[model samples]
Target: MYTELNSILNTTPDSFTQGEFILVSDRQSDASFLMHHFLSFYLRARCKVCFLGLVQSFSHYNAVGQRLGVSLVQAKEKGQLIFFEGLKESLSVLISQESNTKSQAIDFLRDPSVGLRSLYEFVRCTVSSSSGGGEKGADGAEEWGPPVLLVDDLSVLLSLGVTVGTVLDFSHYCRATVCSQLQGNMVMLTRCDGEEEADDGDDEGSERLHRGLTHQCSLTLHVQGLPTGYCRDIHGQVEVCWRRRQGDGQHTQKKLFQYKVHDKGASFFARGTSSAVL
Candidate 1:
């Protein structure tokens, strides 16, 4: 995990922010690093993670996980992580006697209008496995920490012919199950339409979804390409906003930081403190 990012996010290995929804939205740059950050952060926190990786394969994420010093292969082998690979799921739709999460997840491929209930069921089943007086370890302790559900990107469900309302509904149910019912955490990534894409009116649905999630999420990390354009030392900028309900009113605090990704981890800097500025 990134120490600088953890400080900015107020998340530490000893204590975690549970029962909260974190939304990661990307406008004009790659925000996959943020996804990696959380994946490792939660794993290091010992949370049982259900990863719905819609855009990449297991190996792809495993490679990145290795670089971050968290081995996805080992995690899965030890039954700590359950990964849903969209490519494999979409290709194989046969119902299995095994895990219902996979068999039900590709319902959209069979019928576009079937909705994402099956997919949501997968997540609910995975995270709720041992939260109650359920499973235990060999030493008679709880097998894992708090449950966590991480979706690399939620917009791909829309591109696959699911309605915006359906996707939002899925998110709502997942949020309720993870955050409210189980007292766990959820992290979801979505792409927003850029200026040109917005002008062309192509990805308005994604924009709506992003806005909808932003309102529901407790924290939003919106990543955008630098206004000054590309620089070798800087990748993009991130706007971090935290929201809380205070009686009848809501309070929001926002901050912007520039970040650069390196082989080990990423660094977040003040507005102009990166090497590019120096």
Candidate 2:
């Protein structure tokens, strides 16, 4: 699916595993394009995906997928993709009467819950059901592989009034659940807001949250817009830094790339060449 990108990450087909947690940080404007590239890679690899789109509608994702020739609708129909409907859930309190009639509604508003519990439950159930009472292969191994869990933006929860500590706890719980219960991988996209004043406590708090999650992640990728002005033929310039966990500790690598946005889709390439590395 993404041979060069996987090579950059030092992943080999024989050595691939599902336990890693990847955290991608970028400015809000550039994050969407990068996320689409990342998700397309996994989806093309035939990995089942559970997507939690916090900042965008499912239709937006589907449109992007179509442009990229990923056929997200077909993936969903084949039970290879599951969307959690984060946009709908976030607005549920305001638009739906079902919540008002149930005790869940009161808890939803009063508590700082980011709705991770429900998502976790859903993933658990889906995995279990997919197993079909523990279907086995010839050698007594599981017939199916672990799924990939993708969360569009964690900062959306913070914007919705979820505390940093609560969000961290929820993230940790999700990581643990995926690794231990589902044997899957998790990829989370979050914004690194650089606009806040240096002395602002909220800014400090946001930085702390970003650092906290970066520390927990097995791989951390930082995307920054290039300083040069945009060109007619270029969508934008971006520098990507990848830090991966190694046996001894952590190792860092980086690359500079430019992207082009076309009417149908977008593509990224290493600087000065057509070779794509992201």
Candidate 3:
């Protein structure tokens, strides 16, 4: 089921295991495309997926899933897919004009603590519910597999005034909790050049967040966008690096690949190999 992705990782059957944090870094647009590939792979593999979308609307994701041949509606109906509407929640809070204190606009601009807390709570609830037979299953037994938690663009929280420390703590907590308790895999997407585009304080915060998450995560995937107008046939490049915590703590050699986006989905290949354009 995950043949394409497994081929990119050069892994044999039963070699790919869940229960670790995987970080995907890229430009905003490219990151979104790569995320679709990852999510489609897991969903097709019959793993439960909880998608927390902060960068794009739910409709955008639904369209992308459809193009990838993933039936998001069916997944949800089968109790294998759940979505946390981060964008919708933020927009609702920002546009609300009911009886409040000072100004609704100013309140929206303050901090993202409220939103962050809500997100954390939602994740906790979803994880807890999926553990037992809280949701229906195919057979009489509970459909319990290692769930995949995907968060699109963690930088959105930072842009909404979430402190670096808070974000780091939240990430660590989620990774530990999900990997240890639920025995699931957690994937987070972030911008590669965030530190370069922010102010001094934000720059430092972004750098710290990057370093901390890099150390905490078991695997990291870096996506580099091709030079503008340089390669019409290629979409982008990726590097997958991983380390084992149980062994000597040594890192594995990085694997490189290039991908092409098509109507169906993204296809990965060796860096220099030529794939027929779809």
Quote model 1's TM-score: 0.91
Residue 263 of model 3 has an lDDT of 76
lDDT of 2 by residue, 12-41 (tens): 544566688888777534666657765676
Q: Where does the lowest 10-residue lDDT sum fall in candidate 3?
A: 101-110
Displacement of residue 136 (Cα, Å) in model 1 is 2.0
Q: Candidate 3 regions off by >4 Å?
A: 10-15, 27-29, 97-110, 113-115, 134-142, 194-202, 227-229, 245-250, 275-278
User: Lowest summed lDDT over 10 consecutive residues: which window, candidate 2?
Assistant: 101-110
The CA-based lDDT of model 1 is what?
0.86
* Location of the lowest summed lDDT over 10 successive residues in candidate 1: 195-204
Q: What's the best-to-worst order under TM-score?
A: 1, 3, 2
lDDT of 3 by residue, 1-278 (tens): 23576676654333446687888877433667768877776786666688888788878888888887887877877778887666666665667645363223223234666434545666766776777664665576347466778989786667778777777877877886677788888889877554244546445455567667888888888877664534767878877888664665565757877777767766778867846543
Which model, 2 or 3, shows the larger TM-score? Answer: 3
Q: What are the per-model numbers of colliding residue pairs?
A: 0, 0, 0
Top candidate (lDDT): 1
lDDT of 2: 0.66
